[model samples]
Target: MRLRRSARIRGPGGSFLRRPPLRVNVASPIELRPSPDGRFLACGDQVGWLRERGYGVDSDGCRALELYEALYLVERGDAAALGADGAPLDVSGLISLGSKRNPRFLTKYIVYRDLRNRGYVVREGYGLGNDLRVYRRGEYGSRDARYLVVALEEGRRMSASTLGRIYLRALNLGKELVLAVVESHGDVIYYSVSQFNLRRRLDDAA
Candidate 1:
């Protein structure tokens, strides 16, 4: 039998690994609590493991994780989300709770997991009516975001005007707009969107 001399480990494809993981093969899952308003789940700043991976928003010296973030960690066996009663919520329970907080939470989570699995740092998005922001792979926490993501269920339709508006907003923000469609089978399909003026193109060519 062999034992690792050092405890350092990179968290689930994390880049800024400077300390030991929050928990390493520990029997008990690390306990996490929700904010007073039940919007975010937190467990103090000890979650540097999550911070290095760009998972939570820090507040008052604590890093509070979004619903998608906490749910992902719970599924990965690294942490457990606790309810007000101080009982652990399973993945399904967390999903139900998250749904109340954000009706599109499940959809967002599907896309978030897919993006993270494919090696991108996903952050919460706002102001652009976007669902998420994706940093270029390996650029999170250091560089500006590369893409603004909108997640939707498969077979859903969006008017060209709405999509164009989103694309234009992303362009104005100096970012590309990406659409993530999740299928019933939990598969994710990605589409990059941009504003191209067909009318202007025809007029200029003419």
Candidate 2:
């Protein structure tokens, strides 16, 4: 995807600073607290703020932002996310940390960013055998997610059994299953998959 040109924001020194391409209108910058488990970011008091932006709240009634969510928020300049060490991270810094934690970070980011750009509400799929639970635009909070997206590198392959499991889960949940293939050049292609069965009838003439 082609990014929009950076907008100039006046810095403390009266010089212009380059802002990120994506812009989210918010009253204040969202705060992200590192989770105790060291896997996700917790929005304690900022839960409502993030939720208002389409971030989903977990069963615990708090918004537990995933790595991709936090990265996207930080990249879009809508949130100031501190790491486990309580240090602010720029986009490049966050990318570095995310890459270190997840080997497929870049591929997932490409797909996630692309989906968000297309105006879908994306949330991390917890234990659903997918990368994201995507809500159709403007249907968030009013309806269940319409798609379960699994992000994979362009050339990466999945076993038939694994694919079957994922398809079955989506089918049971009554959601469409999408495979987002991220190429090395930062392009994403999406394919929807559904299950079907067929039987052949014996021909009497044969």
Candidate 3:
């Protein structure tokens, strides 16, 4: 007679413990963006910002998912290849997507909405006729309407060193670089430019 194993299992020493086989969970695909250099980024899972447990999955899944997202972004003209940081980039007279098909485009849109809700005057503006710009009600302060540029686009080819330099420049400009890398429709991974901030601080020290 064969004994069927239940959800719970008994050990050799007659100890009752729950030793179950790991299982894979079915997850829906999420959207993310890649750097202009064709490098994947983590934008969090389609579910949320938290990781699921006992899912028998890892960052690899997130990376694969990111690749899938890259495919989609490339299909849309919203993404394009651009030169690296400070490489004599001549964007003048060049047309930009202006956040047409960005996956997180709505997030920034909401930020503008929230600012408007705060009784701040906002207007539609683009940087020297480049991308869109955000302006306050009045007064030309540092926080006035500034040009928003997508330094990197999904599915663009670039060098690692060049990417690093771009990230460093963003940190120097007091901007937190956010990136999302999804793996294989499994999970999405996200990170920020904290390291850039730290490194810049260190450079200042030196």
Q: Report backbone clashes per prediction.
A: 0, 0, 20
Worst 10 residues of 3 by lDDT: 86-95
TM-score of candidate 2 against the unseen true structure: 0.76
Best-fitting candidate, scored by TM-score: 1
> What would the per-residue lDDT of candidate 3 be over residues 55-151, giving only the tens digit for each residue?
1113544432222222222222222223234232111201123233444332233333233333333333222211223333453244644322222
lDDT of 2 by residue, 104-206 (tens): 7766776777788677888877474437888888998899898889889768977666677787788888888888876654456777775642011112212
> In model 2, what are the clashing residue pairs, if there are any?
none
1-206 per-residue lDDT for model 1 (tens digits): 11112222222224312432344543666667888856455555356666888878777767788778888777677787888888878777887888787676777787776677566898888655437888987788789998888989778877666666777778788987788777755566777664555334335555
Q: What TM-score would each prediction reach against the true structure? A: 0.78, 0.76, 0.23
Q: Indicate whether candidate 1 or candidate 2 has the larger lDDT.
A: 1
CA shift at 65, candidate 1, in angstroms?
Answer: 0.8
Native-referenced Cα lDDT, model 3: 0.32
Query: How many Å off is the CA of 104 in candidate 2?
Result: 1.2
- Compute the lDDT of residue 41 as modeled in candidate 1: 56
lDDT of 1 at 50: 68
Best candidate per lDDT, number?
1
